[model samples]
Target: MRRETDRTMDFLDEYRLRPDPADPRLSVAVTGVNEAGEPVETRVTVERALTLFLNSREIVTMMTIGDHPEYLALGYLLNQNMLRPETPVTGIDYDDDLGVVVVRTEAETDFEEKLRKRTQTSGCAQGTIFGDLMDVIENARLPATPLRTSWLYALTHKINQTPSLYLESGAIHGCVLAREDRPLVYMEDVGRHNAVDKIAGYMQHHAIDPADKIFYTTGRLTSEMVIKTVRMGIPVLVSRSGFTAWGVELARKAGLTLIGRARGKRFVALAGAGRLIFDQDLAYVPDEGARHRRKGARAAEDAE
Candidate 1:
């Protein structure tokens, strides 16, 4: 018992976070006020309730923009500890009109007890973490990857310039699965967790390796976000937002490389700093451009 306890204690000390805006593909028309308080007609993010059914039993409803419902459903089940990694998923059925998704697994499954074990998470849109969920943290092996400042700079610039739902519509969060400085998969939703789950689901479905990847977000580095990133076996997390006390603590325990407040050429990493290679010169790194910057984003005026 002492040896097991010590291992768990060591795990507890290890830890991190890991975008995006209104995508026209996911936005709707609405009237809103501008910075000057002038009435303007434009598009706004569209969010709706999506009910998920695992095989025959109803699971839970989520509020999302519905980009990848299949991925969201599978990912949610995986993260909630309801679906084991080796479980064979037969098929995922989604009915967009009814806003319902059903994930058919090869093996018999039930979630009544799992649902009862859920605890509220800090994620927006009512995220839930199940009992024993954290146990998966022990087996999630993140690769010892190196993060360079040059790659960080290039990533931030490209993401800013990409025309997204956030640029057109305002109230949405983006998550990206990136390699080097290029984004491989970009997902957005009403809640940041949902966005992350979609990416997780996609990665799982396609058997994408997390070893050489980085996770990026436009939201805060909260504990929920950090836990998901760690469970996904992602070693590095970058956020344009700041971190929470518990969030930082968790990352440190999990040995996650946490980078937050990543805007333009500026950022701060609290844990796993050894993974960061500061290979870029500040003078050569360009500040974020105006049009690409999010509304109310930290300006480069000081660097101006």
Candidate 2:
């Protein structure tokens, strides 16, 4: 049986998912003076769909460019902090007739109640609030190890070079989960939130450790994004874009090392500097006057 992530591979995989052996249309234009800059036109067929579902009897729908629906569903729950060991995820089934996903969980609970209790905050593009999961972030902890800048750069480059289904279709977002700088899971969706949820779902299903790894995204570091990373207990969060003020503040409070504008060999540290290590063999001089005064005072006090 294929997992949700596997079902998503129609876009992620090089193989075609359309049984009819067809390709989505592409757009082109002739803008040149026979090859010089002139008037041109192009056309392309893009894929889009409304994914609907009944959770606790409320109809929830997400608009997405078709790719990785299973992982999207699973990742949605995990990233939203709705997954529990005993919350039976009966099955995720697709209904072609209804054009929706049928998610069967173990028991029926007050889902709307759970959702309302969460705080409402916005993020880059389309995003939702996380009303009830703040405590989870505050209590979460990661290892006290130093993260080298080399590995951070390697991870950013890997994200840039990843094979994305969205780039092919020109309309989806991507999210990746990594361990010690190597990507272990990658996903894409029309919705950035959905892509994140899929990665979170994959981690939950596999029982992966959040403390030993990082989460990378093409999305900006919004408060909602911070909440998701915090929920996972992951120590580091990096993105190719920028961060909002609140996101950085929450990251600092949670002791998470947030990296933004991470590309090539440069990155901005928004919080938790203690977790990062400067390159070895780099030389720096201590402030002699200040150091001497402090050390001398300590030595004289100890002698007394």
Candidate 3:
């Protein structure tokens, strides 16, 4: 049962430069006022879905910016835990005429097991994940990376400054994979989780290390989102929106840093404050530390 949305807005397809260099350039009118308060127009790309198949079986489809179809397919499967580093992927084929990606996998996976593992997600973009529909806070590792205020600022500003299809069409969500203070990859989709999956697929295909990277999303931090980060073994998950209670609890158990409301200079650490290394104890007071030290000394004296 293959089902997909029909609301594909192909700004890129509708606006393409002609091969004839001698011809005058073409332009289209876009809605919006510019800095001079005049109606402005900018060239943008189209977004659409490309179906994915594994060994002739329909696995899933992705809604993306149509710029990187192969990468998106590969990334999506990896994030969904459908494929691991050792999984033997024989080949991948993309049919532009039909807009479908056929992936050849050698792993003899049970069809029913694969189907049962899928869960329809609430991500702004269409997302499917493995295991239980909702997360249970167990088996998530504790976070060991220290979060810095400066890193958060850079991450938020970098996300805002990244090139986006949404800025032109206002209809997409973006996901970025960052390492330390720098963003390594950015992907946008009609669905937020799909964007992250695309990135994950790319990482898996390229065998990129994700141990120290931070995953950022334009959508809310749901429990499934936390699980995705956990699957990648990444310790940090930052979002521009709020986190669900399940997400917070999972992060606490997983030892992952859950940063939410990542806008401007005001961001909330929803869980795992141990990862946050403050230069000046913003949450801890030196007086409290001294008081504790004094109490310990008094206890020792009383014992003596």
Against the true structure, whose TM-score is highest? Answer: 1
lDDT scores of the candidates, listed in order: 0.79, 0.62, 0.65
TM per candidate comes to 0.86, 0.73, 0.73
Q: By lDDT, who's the top model here?
A: 1
Name model 1 segments beyond 4 Å from true. 1-25, 32-38, 108-110, 292-304
The parts of candidate 2 lying over 4 Å away from their true place are 1-47, 52-56, 117-120, 166-171, 280-304
The ten-residue window of minimal lDDT in model 3 covers: 17-26
User: Model 3 off-target regions past 4 Å?
Assistant: 1-45, 133-137, 280-304
Better of 1 and 2 by lDDT: 1
* Model 1 superposed RMSD (Cα): 8.6
Residue-level lDDT tens digits of model 1 in 161-259: 666677777688888877788777777787989988888897788777787788999888988888889988889999988899988988887778999
Q: By lDDT, highest first, what's the ranking?
A: 1, 3, 2
For candidate 2, lDDT tens digit of each residue in 1-304? 2333333423234222211112343212223343566655532224455464535453346765545566666666666655553476778887655657766686765566666765556743446653466766677675555677767766656555554454343445567776655666776655667667777766666556576777888777988888888876778888866789988988888888898866454478888777887662323312123221234344644597
Give the Å error, residue 12, model 2: 12
Residue 143 shift from truth in candidate 1, angstroms: 1.9
Q: After superposition, how far is residue 167 of candidate 2 from its true place, in Å?
A: 4.4
* Ranking, TM-score, top scorer first: 1, 3, 2
lDDT of model 2, residue 148:
78
